[model samples]
Target: MAHATSIQYEPVAEIGGGAYGTVYKARDTESGQFVALKSVRVQTDQNGLPISTVREVALLKRMEQFDHPNVVRLMDVCATTRSDQETKVTLVFEHVDQDLKTYLEKTPSPGLSPERIKDLMRQLLCGLAFLHSNRVMHRDLKPENILVTSQGQVKLADFGLAKIHSCHMALTPVVVTLWYRPPEVLLQSSYATPVDIWSTGCIFAEMFRRKPLFCGESEVDQLGKIFEVIGLPPEEEWPTDVTLSRTNFPPLMPRPIADFVPEINEQGAQLLMKMLTFDPLKRISALNALEHSYFQDEETLTQKKS
Candidate 1:
């Protein structure tokens, strides 16, 4: 922790690590603000840095304009200059209280009550709506990427795999981790914003149950878990020419959601099922989900029942 010509980075304890970078909680003296500095480890083949990191940095830089309550803020980008080696670029972001994984782990089972679940889901939907409105697809949406602030607000992070619907790149099925991946992605179809809705559904179930709704080890297993809770994918649900790498089409009837989590209410089950729909076209959009009875307030519920 040293202060130099207007730019001082105070390195705090390590927050987390990723494939190419190690994230540390830090303070930027220039702005007198706390930020998460993700330092990309420099490798040698006589090459500078990975192209993927460059892409992430560039995208995140542009995405800074997306200042929303539910979206993680990228503060600044700086370089670390050492004694005698190649310099490294560090991406700075807003410091979050904790990731949803650690948050869930620390909390007791039946941790988040129904009201809290609705609040979290509402915040998630708000974030997703903002991202979709900006045409940004968060390919990876899971507990690990959803962070909770000390103020109890949830914000979406980890834009390394995010794809901004811009003129710069082509849309490919660059699917994220198997767990949060949508059914359309599992079927090898070029995915869109609906994929995030699918992940949000999974996260919503997870927050309510305090565990992964679908803890599948592989793609087939993942699809199996999804099907188990939400039912199988009909052949007509998929596009004719779409290709699947692992699982076969004409899926068998899946097990019931009640069998897995009997405590979930009928409204919750219906909402989850719609989000997990095999057909992207049929999947619930985040905006529409926010309007659903699933997120209804006490007043709204009374009105609906009456």
Candidate 2:
């Protein structure tokens, strides 16, 4: 049944009716602070919470203890059982009014400065690296879920929640875009943390172009779109387990990253290529990506400014 802590949050409005389950803006009566309440209804079925949901929640809670600057704060968690078969798991997160999607849309016609993009990518990678090091794969990463604070802090939200969302939705109605997905995932190959790095690379290019790099309509279409830029991998590079043949894509050579992300410099393009590499094994890890030469300019400029 519904309980006391649930009342502690006075609902202000429904923020999301889609992807992240039911999310609400609520006022914490005690602290007089605003927070986002994301509720997921999980099938209990005699066991308290499904093992998957329990594992995800544990991972989120563990990550919370680190108090990462670039990861959203998970403030509170409450479970209110509605029936023997169902339980509502409400997760309270510190609210941020803007997401990267909104931030990109609001950018002036000239678009974000290279320095601003660098700063955002740096923060994004830091958070991602933290999660990767902790053995957590974000599975889903895109502009909508990457929250941006008023002060321009980039906090990675919606990590470790895809499992919970899927548990509730069966198959979420939200049209999950293949735009940010890595090549392996599109091919139905096994994926790990590198999946997120590929998504970050897509987001990186999007920062420059102010629109998604690859907008594929389906898995095959998305792979074709990706290969159009990265080019089809060699026969040996293709995963043996996937049914999709490398011949499904053309024999075109890799295009210049600059062709798509024109504003990116030589260093940025090189790093982006490493990120978008076809082989998951060859993909750049978030920690290694942070050390890429592309970010050095920003570091040098920071040193000069200080």
Where does candidate 1 stray beyond 4 Å? 1-7, 30-32, 39-63, 79-89, 160-176, 245-251, 301-306
TM-score of 2: 0.95
Clashing pairs in 2: none
- Tell me how far the alpha carbon of residue 286 in candidate 1 is from the true structure, in angstroms, after superposition: 1.0
Cα lDDT tens digits, model 2, 193-224, are 99999999999999999999999999999998
Report every candidate's CA lDDT: 0.72, 0.90
The list of candidate 2 runs beyond 4 A from truth reads 169-174, 301-306
Best by TM-score: 2
TM-score against native, each model = 0.79, 0.95
As a whole number from 0 to 100, the lDDT of residue 222 in candidate 1 is 83
Best by lDDT: 2
Cα distance off (Å), candidate 2, residue 247? 2.0
